[model samples]
Target: MEFDLSWILLGLPLAFVLGWLASRFDLRQLRAENRQAPKAYFKGLNFLLNEQQDKAIDAFIEAVQNDPDTSELHFALGNLFRRRGEYNRAVRVHEHLLSRGDLGPADRDRAQHALALDFLKAGLLDRAEEALKPLEGTAFESEARLALLAIYERSRDWPQAAAITRKMQASGQGDFSARQAHYLCEQATAASAQGDEATAHTRLTEAMAAAPQAPRPRIELARQQHRQGQPGAAVDTLATLAAQAPGALPLATPLLIEAAAAAGRSAEALALLGRHYEQMPSLDLLEGLVALDRASGDATRPGRNRYVEHLAKEPSLVAATQWLATEQLEHEQFHPQIQRALDQAARPLMRYRCAACGFEARQHFWQCPGCQTWDSYPARRVEEL
Candidate 1:
């Protein structure tokens, strides 16, 4: 063993030389691959900037093939495919990323999100839901839940929409109380249509509790009570509506007057009507007041005179038409022709217009039928706005 010391020293130097050569060989191979990857990547970037997406995709695919473990390049390719409406290709690229065992948690979540988006854009909602569900506890949770909420809404799955909204509210995404109230209202309406009065009542009550300041639930509940032969209850509900959400009273003027008359609450009704008219004069409210006054037959002021008074406050063609129609003209021969022409001109002015998209309808909507926006319509008519 002592005689082999010189041989051991010589063998150590030879082994070190071989090791160095092997390291250099591996580094050269890695550098060559890295150089090819960047060149392909830059080519892809150039094509992308030039708006040559198809060529960019080809270059990106080449780059990804050269650098197979590059999560970023795979993401870029997947997103580019989606932007080009090549959803199948995007899904494939993302699916590949998800299948890789070496992919980090963040990249895996990103691929899952991309896959869901692909399915959503392609109208494969069922697939999208499956893809998005696993991302619930990830950083993509909020966005995933929002997408799921939209899916449920589009499918008219009110229960699912409510569940998602509750979760989002719990997460402090924003106050979803109003939207949850709307969901309950929708469920109530559906229950009412199906002759499930008890369920409808419960749902409407929940909606009211969910959004105490929301006017629709109270209004709807009053209608339900009136239909169920509970005029007293209906009147009481409307009284609460008048006190709590007075800004919405004009829109419900006719219903309130009817309910009040049914319950024999004329004095209370008159007081509420007068207060609303004084604050914000609406043509509908004025008409309701005239009807209530006429019904009471305790008319201190003429019912038609309210129209004239409204005209004094605002140069309303609608009010002028109403006043003139209620009067007998001395020139009776031309009165019919004048009335017909005025009515024709005022017809369009009575329609409700969406403030968001400028779409007009003959009736007011809580949600804009044109733009699908909630509470976009003002309580006032087109002429008032």
Candidate 2:
């Protein structure tokens, strides 16, 4: 029980010295680990900047292995895999990140988004949809919903696309009324093809109601009415369209002529078309005017004469061809060859072209096949545009 003062004093300093040395060792170890992680990351970044994706991937893998807890590095690696078209590896990396309990809520959401992107890029739409569903109510909700909408559209799932669009509209994404109307029109088209005229009519009516100013719904509804042997109703629908969406009358010209003739309202339809042509002077409108004139037996200026009038206004090859078709050349024997050459030259000008993607087609499309853009194609023909 005797106290030793010297030994007590010596032990105190030794304990202090040991504690200081331990702290120094820990700091040095931490600095070394940090340096190693950054070295690998910078190597990866250098490789990426140099366009050496293979080496970049290798370096990123090394960095991830060295700093397993780094969520940012994991994300980078996952993205690189996806960019390289290694979707499986990208999916696995993101899934691994999700499985880790230490991940934060934000990181978990990010990883889930990355996994969905991987599935989408791999063309596994079903899996992508499932993965994207959980992102609702999160910060990534808008992005996920947009992806889902695209998937539904690509699959031609009109109802699902409409539902997603409605949600987007509700969330203040933008006004999707026109797009919703298009979906209903697509549904009507399918129903009509299946011989469900009643359903098609209902859907077309709903489409018209959804977007009163949209031209497609009225045009489609009129077409459906005409097909169902209701020419008078079709004429009425087209007349409303002419008053409200007159800019789109050219696209609906042929339909109008047919409906007018069937309903015994050729004169009224001709007057409406004449007014539109006076304002816009579209070739389609002029063609519609000529058809109606011929149908009504106009003697002063025949259908073919309208072409010469159009040629006077616009120096169009299409108009020239139409005018020449009705003319009797001095060398009547060579008329056929001349007409054929002119027709061949004017054929391409009749095609509709997309303003967004520069895609040309014989028929106008509400959505572009090349770029999947809605209302990308103008109603005007290539020459007119």
Please name the candidate that would achieve the greatest TM-score relative to the true structure: 2
Off by over 4 Å in 2: 1-27, 330-334
Off by over 4 Å in 1: 1-36, 46-52, 293-300, 324-345, 353-359
How many residue pairs clash (N, CA or C atoms closer than 3 angstroms) in each of the candidate models, in the order given?
0, 0
Candidate 1 per-residue lDDT over residues 155-193, each given as its tens digit: 889899999999999989999888888899999999999
Judged by whole-model lDDT over C-alpha atoms, candidate 2 comes out at 0.93
- The TM-score that candidate 1 achieves is 0.83
Predicted structure with the largest lDDT when compared to the true one: 2
lDDT of 1: 0.91
> How would you encode candidate 2's per-residue C-alpha lDDT over 132-190 as one tens digit per residue?
99999999999999999999999999999999999999999999999999999999999
lDDT of each: 0.91, 0.93
